[model samples]
Target chain A: MVKTVASVGLPVDEVLEIKKNRILPEGESDGKKKRISIVTGIHGDELEGQYVCFELIRRIEEHKELLKGIVDVYPAMNPLGIDSITRGIPAFDLDMNRLFPGNKDGDMTEFLASGMIADVDGSDVCIDIHASNIFLTEIPQIRINELHKEKLIPLAKELNVDFIWVHGANTVLESTFAHSLNSRNVPTLVVEMGVGMRITKEYCNQLVDGILHLMETMEIWAGETIEPRKPIISEDADDVTYLNAPTAGVFVPRVKHWEHLKKSDEIGWIIDPLHGKILEKILSPVDGILFTIREYPIVDHGSLIGRLLREEARKE
Target chain B: MEKKIIYEISSLYRDNFRVTGFEFGEGEKSVCIVGNLRGNEVQQIYTCSQLVQKFKVLEKEGKIRKGHKVLIIPSMNPYSMNSKERFWPTDKTDINRMFPGYDLGETTQRIAAGIFEVIKDYKYGMQFASFYMPGKFMPHVRMMQTGFENVEMAKEFGMPYVVLRKIRPYDTTTLNYNWQIWETNAFSIYTTSTTEIDKESAKEAIRGILRFLAKQQIIEYTTHEGYKSSVVTDSEMISVRTKSAGIFDSKVKAGEEIAKGQILAQIIDPLEGEVKENLISPVDGIVFFGHNDPLTYANTAVFKIISGGI
Candidate 1:
């Protein structure tokens, strides 16, 4: 069944509405059933979660007899952004993700955010999905705050991601949806995958399998489930090395993404297209595995080119 | 006045990024004024420049108090300001948002950490801030209700209004909130303009700051008691929103008094050149803020009015 989570009056006699798809156990109206929320599209350009939402519902309906709990899929949180292909709410130029647990008495955007948070407040678990910007491509991974490590890391392992990054807490996290839900003890896990403005079917399929496995673990689904792959966990901040551009130019990668490299290996070359000369040679600073790589070719000084997980940290 | 480089970051391709500070008096860290963390805040930098000139005269005449020091940073993000970009030119990150920042973090964070480290221990912190929306504001002093905010001290500025905002979760990362957390009396002063310099309001803001310094005994200068500032919370303000997306024709400027049901602005259709909607005031009040942009989106707040007279 479809339900409107938030509605606000817009211009031209228009109304902006956020809707969600709720699937429940066959013929069961029990309010005590465990519920999981799958949320995405906080950024309109990140559409990886759209396919996952559709696939989750389609498979659940296919095996309706085995469903035992509630599943709510909120695909488009910023519908205007999705419609206009903007990263944030088009007219406001505001990031929807930054307005979590918003003020009820504030502006229209804040009211909408507050309503959405209230609607998803009491879930057993929530998976907040996101994709990288158009400039970068990220492998399937889950980012967990070190503050919520003990309670969240074990749950994140069931998501079939390639890596689990346990990062230190920052003031910025207090306004995020996952942080707000976790503060409420809802056990929200943030999943980041693929690149913005494009969808990778393989990553979506992997995440779907992982979500089903998680559902089975919670006894929300009694159907068959696959065992999720064990993910590499990173806890120390020093274990990751950031690669930034040395000069402004066109970046030409010489190495494949996600490849292991030794110290001083050539990762890429920043070339001056107009001058026909190599401006700078990008190299691996340490023995590590590259997990993040820039997708766009344009390079500016101080632009992040990639991130490498130290090899020793991986072994640990 | 002595000019000094407070923080510097060496660059390979260009001149090093430097945050420069002008010191007026030489004693205890009494007050620190920061301006234009973003590139487009032309009015803020201009206000700070005027303050610098005023301080030079005051310091030459020995008007500064003997036991106090005053520091003014006119512009923080000069790299972005040079390129006419609002944020960091390379990554488009906001330096203002990265307050009390991480030294080993990204470029903006490092810059923030560098600047904050030098000015965090002052007795009073003043930031010339701009609104997120492109608008003109009645010159006022704003404080975040962070339990550490001092509304009494804010009123010393003698601005027309003292706005106390209920702190939100995201606000914890802002410079004013962090300064308050660090036990410094922090306030954000908003002028009538941001990108363009409004001479009248800039002078008003300068007078307000000088009055505040005199009140705190940081300087021996005397200025007019600007206003009996009215204390108002952000929630008490009424927002007037446009019903159509079009060219906005504002009927009243910021700081204007209006009656209930008064037409505040008109949204004119771009193609047909006809008024689509006339935004009317819902309450009799003073306009605290008014949108200054040429075009506005549907449902955007065009004016913020403080309901009722002070």
Candidate 2:
């Protein structure tokens, strides 16, 4: 059996010496086919993606003969986040994922990103895996630039996920790995599923299968023929309603992630832990899908509790 | 002993909602001590307050033989303390990071400026702080790139260790960097993390302060039996980072030494019933502070190993 991993970055010592970041790759395939790079663990605390990548790596290793092209995998881009179980590097308090393409001499993130990005360069496709923001539970989905619908829509379909959100390129700046890769003319798909610090096996399985499906479509791996998943492409993805807490209390969410709700549906209630009084009962403001819900209970006034995916009726 | 309540900054509620800045044992040498910049750092503020009360009684009896004017701001961030928060009430900003604070900025900066304004006349300054996390810390003095005078004075503080470091500015812009700009001798001292208070750390801090006083010839340095210290430079400190995010299974205790690559802890994936990584010691040294909570994130510091022999 061919060993799957290409390299593991040893921690760099400082002037005298200090152990720094770690990076793991999938393989150094001599095959000249178009390549795909699946990367995760930029924020160590957001581990759902890490599991997904591991599963893919295992499958690729077990079936190496089926792989037609190189699939470089960097399991963790930020070891600091993984070590601390935090979204940001604890010591410097820097967000590793936010430091895009990365500076060679900057902080730890810059140095790590530079090396990781180099390994990923020249790949035909890139998949930057991430968990949802800790504050919300996002449906497992692949995000692509809305403008790239002509080229990426079919590719998104091949992922076999629930949603293929063709988001605008202007959503966030080129400060993210996916954005940086996309800017470099590589077709990139940013995958987001589950929530930070917690793993849902169902979502992880979904992402693993989706990545396999994409590999199969690119002819990198030959597997079972997958039925293409039709996605609910939102035209106005930015018109999202954010429900905030009215008082400081423990938020008890009634709605689950990916649930559909009608207007006035009781979503959650904030209860005062000290007095045992129901502080506020949040109701759905519009007939929409429950896109997100806050998992951590401790909430204050103005804390974003949930978000609604507004539905726009199809034109005749 | 002139007893009068002086307001560091006028409170929004009332003028008397003031920080009781304590001035003790007046002389040629002056030292300013501040504590409880974060409201969650209750123990630190309480200790400073108790120290003030102890000195006040001793001064009343004409017992404190110090020729230095020691000023204590027991609770600098009163608003946060009142709300029982780590940051200010309006905006959650750490007050300690607000160095060389603005006189008229946000809540945290204003508090920093007001505190700086009161301590500006002092010859030497020491800031007291508690960590956000819980752990016992060795009494060490931290100074930025200011110079050796502060380090020399820190030696006089007679703490167990004198830690030299350069860190990015946060809390308020008026912190260590600001103190450096003023060309004043300063040190930031802490017992441990934010939550738990260690009695030994408190004792070390108080002892260090007393030692500094004695070294200044303001008081006599009395050596406590069996409480000797080992001095280590910044380079000697080793930080042990966790390899994975899981429930940390720490096999080694702090203050103990083990050979290089010895199993210190295991980051276990509870669901899979598998040990993700076996975190081993990178250096032969004593573990100063490790993760108090078993559950930790990846990239979190599991142990601070000091290499120099004690």
Candidate 3:
């Protein structure tokens, strides 16, 4: 069943609405059933989660007898952004993710965010999915803050992602959706995958499998689940190396993404299109696995080209 | 006044990003004024430029106190300003939100870190800030209620109002909030306009800053006494939101005295040119803020009025 989580009147007799799809075990009373929410599309340009939402619901409906708990799917949290293909809210030019735990008495955007938090407050678990911006493509990974490491790391490992990056606490995290929930003692995991404005089917499928496995662990699903792959967990900040463009040029990749490399390996070339000259040869500084690569070719000085996970850290 | 490049980042295609500081006098770091962290804050940078010009004359005349130093940075994000963008041109990130930033973080964070390192330890910090919404404000000094905030100090600015805002979670990352946390008496001054220059309010804001500096004994200058600033909390203000989305026709401007039930604005339909709604005031007060944009979306706050009493 579909329900409107929040609605606001727009000009010209129009209305802005956020809706969610709720699935419950067939013919069973929802009394005290464990609930897991799958949230996505906080950024309009991120469409990878849209496929996951569809696949999760499609599979759940296909086998109604195997479901024993409640599942909530919130797709397109920023519907306007999705409709217009903009990263932020269209008219407001505000990032939706930054307004988490919003004020009920605040403006339109804030009120909407508040409503979302209220609706998802009592879930047993939540998975907030996101995609990298248009500038880069990320391997399916879960990012956790170090403060929530004790509670989230074990849960994140069950998500079948390639990497679990535990970041140090930052002030900006207070206003994020996952942080808002986690601080409230609501277990939430943030999953980042693929690239902006496009969906990767394989990535989406991988996440859907992980979500099912998580549901089984929470006893929310009674269906068969696959054994998820062990993921590399990086807690130390120094375990990752960022590759930045040395100069402004078009980047041409010399190696495939996710390829393991030795030190001084050529990863890409920054070439000047007009002069047909190789301005800079981007090389790996350490032996590692390339997890994030620039999606868009245009690069400026200091633009991030890719991120490498050190092989030694992975082995540990 | 001595001009110095405080923080700079080399750009490959464009000029190196430089945050230039204009300094006056030569000893204790008494005050630091920042302007235009966002690209579209033209009025803010303009106000700081005027201050820079004033300080140069004051220094030449030996009006600046011997042991006090003042630094004024007119514009911080010139790259975005050059491209006519409000935030960082490449990443569209707001530098104002990345306070006391991390040096090894993203571009905006690094820029913020570099700027904050030099300006953090000043005795007083003032930021010419623009509102999130495109609007006009009745030039006021706003301080975050961070427990360390001294309301009496804010009143010294002598603006029409000294607003004490309760810090929201998002406010924690702002420059004003972070500066206060770092033991600096920080205040955000909002003028009448952002993208466009409102000379009258600009002059009023400048006078307020000058008055505060003189009162603090940071500069040996005399300026006319400004407003006897009324202190008010954020809860004392009432917001009027539009009920319809259309071409907005505001009936009044900021700083106007309004009566209860007064028609504040009209929402006119775009297609048929019909009046959709007339926004009426609920209380007799002064218009503290008025939406400056021509269009209005449904449920958008068009006006913020200060209630009848403090």
The 10-residue segment with the lowest total lDDT in model 1 chain B: B8-17
Report i-RMS for every model: 4.6, 11.4, 2.7
DockQ versus reference, model 2: 0.03
Candidate 1 per-residue C-alpha lDDT over A40-123 given as tens digits, one digit per residue, 9 for 90 to 100: 999998999999999999999999999999999999999999999988777566778888888665666777889889999999
Clashes per candidate, residues 3 or more apart or on different chains? 0, 32, 1
Q: State the C-alpha lDDT per candidate.
A: 0.88, 0.66, 0.90
lDDT (Cα, tens digit) per residue for candidate 2, span B76-115: 7676777776565543556666666665354455556766
| Highest lDDT model number | 3
Q: Which stretches of candidate 3 lie over 4 Å from their true place?
A: A28-32, A245-249, A271-280, B268-278
What TM-score, computed on C-alpha atoms, does each candidate reach? 0.84, 0.52, 0.93
| Model with the higher TM-score, candidate 2 or 3 | 3
Native-vs-model 1 lDDT?
0.88
The 10 consecutive residues of candidate 3 chain A with the worst lDDT sum are A7-16
| Model 2 spans with C-alpha error above 4 angstroms | A1-316, B1-17, B27-29, B65-67, B131-134, B169-174, B225-235, B272-274
